[model samples]
Target: MDLTRDQVEAAVRALRPDMFDFAYWVPEMAKEYRVTSVLYSVVSATAIAHDLSPGSELGVPPPGYPSSKVLFRAHDAHALSSLSIFYKRLYHRMTTGLMNCDIISMRTCQEVEGKFCDYIARQYQRKVLLTGPMLPDPEKSRPLEDQWSSWLAGFRQSSVVFCALGSQITLERDQFQELCLGMELTGLPFLLAVKPPKGAKTIQEALPEGFEERVKGRRVVWGEWVQQPLILAHPSVGCFVSHCGFGSMWESLMSDCQIVMLPFLGDQILNTKLMTEELEVSVEVPREETGWFSKESLSAAIISVMDKDSELGSLVKRNHAKLKEILVSPGLLTSYTDKFVEALQNLLNDTNLE
Candidate 1:
C-alpha cells in the first residue's frame, strides 16, 4: 500500500501528543522512583488501542474488564458509548496481559483476590500480586512525626483517635456536625483534619456555629492538614475514623488501628463491608431511616471500636493486629515490584512490537 505525505502528516499530528506524553513522563517518573518499568492502569482507551490493534485477533473478548462490562450491562453500557464496539473488538487482540498487586492481604480482601486469581488471572493469563499492603515511609514526614510524638507523649497508648477523611472528601454540614459531636461525645482525645466545603469562606464556616468553641480543647483537635501515615503509626492513635478509601483502609490496616468506616462510594462500600463483616477489623456507624445518622449512633460505634473490654472491640483489635503484621512484612513489595519489572523487561525483549 502506498502512503501519501499528507496522510502521514495527519497521522503524526493525531498521535504526537500521546507519544510525547509517554516518552517524556514515563522515563522521568521511573528514574525518580528508581523503578525499571512502569505499568499504566487503564483509565482510558488509549493504552488498549495503542498496544492492541483492531481486527488483529478475533474472539469472545477479554474476560476481566470490557467483557465483564458487556456481560453485566448487556445493551445498556454499550448503547451509551460510541466506542463500545471498538472496545469489544480491541480486547480480543490484547495479546499481552497485565498484573495487579494487592495493597491488602488476600485474607483481608476475602476471596475478592481469589476470584480475580481464578477468573481474571487464570483466564487472561494476567499476574496479580496479593502479597501484602505497602506503606509510606514515615521518615519523609519528619516535622509532623516530631509534633505527633511530642503531642502523643501526654496520652497513653491506644488512647487517641486519628480522624481524617482525606484531601478530596468533604462532608455536608449535617454530616460534619454529627461526626464532630459524636467524636466529642466519645470523650477520647482526637485529631481531625478536614477541608472546608466548596464555596465556604473559611474552614470555620464548614461547621455549625458554636461547634468549635464547645469542642475546643475539650477532647478534639482540628487541623487543615496532618501527615497521615505517621499519625496512624503513632502509639497514641487507637482508632482511625476514615472515609474508607482504599488508601485509608490499607493505612489503617497496616498501622493496626481499629477502623471506623464511613464510606460513600462503591469501592469504599465494598472495602468497608469486607473490613466490618468479613475481616472483623472494623465497624460501621448506624444511620437513621432518612439516611441521616445521629451523633449518638456514631458515638456508640466509636466506643465499641475503642473499648478494649468489649467483645467486638477485642475481635477488631486482634484482627487488626494480624492484618497489620501481614501488611508490614518485608519482601512482599520487593517481590511484587521485581516481578512487575521482570515482566516489562520480557515484554521489551519480545520481537512482537511494530
Candidate 2:
C-alpha cells in the first residue's frame, strides 16, 4: 500500500513518545511532516491539562460523581510534584505533545473511561478518539511455556495466584521480602514474576529466611520474564496481583482471573482507582500514608477476592465477568480500530481540501 509522509508520521507517533527532550519539537515535526494525529495515554492527557491549563477546575467532582470520585485529590497533587526530575521532564514533554497535536487519541475505549475521556476532550477542545484496548490476539501468539504449563496444570482450576509487577518496578529489599511473605501467607499456590529487589543479586537471595522451605512446591518466585497473558489464561490461575500498568490492566480485564491491584507509580494509581472505584471490577491492597503496603494487607486483599463465600469477591467477579464479556465480544476491538481509521482518513481529506 502506498502511504504519504503524513501517514507514516502519524503511525509512528501513535506509539507513545519516549524522547523527553523532543516534546518541544512536536509542533515543528507536525508542521514539517503534515502529521494528522497524535495519541496520548488518557491519564497523561488528563494530567497534562490539569497541570498546564490556567484556572482548570479538575479538583471539583463532576455533577453526579461523588467527592471520592474526583480524579486527582490533594494527595495525588503532592505525589505528582514529588516525582523525580526525570519523570517531571517526561511529563512536560507529554504536555507539549498534547498541546500541539491536531487530533488526540488514546489506547482505551469509552466504555471503560468515558467520563475521563470526555473531560480530556473538553479540556483540550479536540476530539478524543479511542482505539479500544488494542490487546494482542492470543490465538496468534505462541502457546504458554512448557515449564509454566506443566506447573500450572498441577493445581486445580482457578486456584493459583499469579503476581507480576511488570519489568520496571523494583522494590527495596525489605519490601520485596514482605511481598514474597505476603504470597506465602495466603497459603495458596502462586507464581511471582518480578525483578530482583534492590541490593540483591537474585530473587533467591532476597527471600525471607526459611521462605523457600516454608512454601516449597507451592510458590515460584521468578526473577525473569514470563508469558503473562498466557499464564493468566491458564485454567488453574484464578487471581492476578498486578501493578496496574496500562498493558497489564487490559490483559487483566480480558482474562477470567480476579484482579488485585498493587500500583506503584502515578498513572498506575489512577488506573487502580478506575478499576477499584469507578468500574468496581477489582480490589486494591490498602497502603499506608507512606505508600507502603504490608504483607498482611496484600494477603487479605487476595483472600477477599479468592474466597468463594466473600461478598466482595462475588461482587467484583460478577462485575468483571460482565465487563469481560463485552470487551471480548466479537468485533468489539475491530470496530474501534475501524472507526479510528475512518476518523484519521477524514482528517487527512479535510486537510487536503483546505
Candidate 3:
C-alpha cells in the first residue's frame, strides 16, 4: 500500500542526492517486490529533479556479498541463472539512460556487449568494462552429475532437449502451441520448464489441442518448473531451445548443447541478435509482424538447429566452447569486480572523469 500523499511527498523531498551514486545490487529485486515500475520512475525522477550530472561510470554489482561465491559454488542452475539476469538488467539500465553509470555487464549477450561497447565509444567515449558470463567450475559442477542422474531417472543418456525461458517473459497461447509442435518435430525426448500464461491451468489447455498425446512418451515432458541447470547439465540433453535470456543461454552453452534462439522481449531480442551475429553460438528464429512466433516458423528453426551433423550446429558448438571457457574460469569474475570498483573509485576522485 502507498503511504499517505503527504508522506510520499515528504519522502521524495527528503531523498538524498548522494543516493544517485549508490549502486543497486540487483535490479530484479524490485520486480520480486512488485515495485519495478515505481522504482524505475523514482530513480528517473530523482536524477532529473536534482540536476544530478550522470556519473562517468556506473558501477553496478551483482547481488549479495562476495561470500555468494562459496555459498553457491555447487548450487543448482536456478541460483546462478537468477543472479545473471539481475546483473544484465541492472547493467542495461545503467548504460541506457540519463543515469550514465558504467555497467559491469556479464559477457553473455552480444546485444549487451554491442550496446555497452557503443555506449562507451559513442556516448562515454571510453572502453567498456565487462565481467564474465561467470560459470561454475567444471570440477565443481561434475559432482552434481550423479545427483542430477537420480533426478532425471531413465532420461539420463543423450536424449533429452532442455527448454527454458527466463523469469521475466511469458508466452502467448499461440506461441506456446507452436513451441509444443516444434518439440514434437524434434523427434528427441524433451523436458520443458514452462510457466503457464496469466490464467491457464494446464499447459494442455494452452498448448495445441491433442498436442500432448501426439508426442506422448517419446517426445515430451512439460512442467511449470524443472531443475533447469540440472536438466541442462544432464548427459541426456542433446539440445536447448531457449528465449536467449542470458541465464538460459549460459546454462545451455556450458552444457555443450546446440541452441535455437527464440527471443521474445526486452534485451532478449538484442541478446539473441548477439548470439546469432557476434558470437555465432545459435540460430535466430523468425518472429512475425506483431513479433509473435508461429508453429511453421518454430518447426523450421528447431529442425535447422537440432541437426548434429549440420554446419550451423558445428559452428554453434565451437562458439559455445569459447564462451564457456570465459564463464567457468576461476577468479575471473573476482578480477573483474576488483577492476570495476577501482574504476569507480578513480571516477569518484576525478571531477572531469565522465
Candidate with best TM-score: 2
Q: Which should have the higher lDDT, number 1 or number 2?
A: 2
Using lDDT as the measure, the top candidate is 2
Per-candidate Cα lDDT values, in order, are: 0.56, 0.77, 0.53
Candidates ranked, most accurate by lDDT first: 2, 1, 3
TM-score of every candidate: 0.66, 0.86, 0.63
Worst 10 residues of 2 by lDDT: 16-25
Per-residue accuracy of model 1 over 175-213 as CA lDDT, tens digit each: 777777788888888887777665675566666668777
lDDT of 2 at 246: 81
- Evaluate model 3: give its TM-score: 0.63
The TM-score obtained by model 1 is 0.66
Model 3 lDDT per residue over 1-354, tens place: 223435433443465221122123222322232221111221211111111123422222123211111121121222335445644555445434323333322342232243333333343333444444555555555344454466456774656776777676666666676777777776767777677755677766687778777777656545455667766766777778898766676677667777888766434554555567756788876766555666677667766766767777777778887877875567655676577557655554552343
Scanning candidate 1 in windows of ten residues, the lowest lDDT window is: 101-110
Worst 10 residues of 3 by lDDT: 42-51
Candidate 2 residue runs with Cα over 4 Å from true position: 1-24, 40-87
When 2 and 3 are scored with lDDT, the better candidate is 2
Per-residue error for 224 in candidate 3, Å, reads 2.5
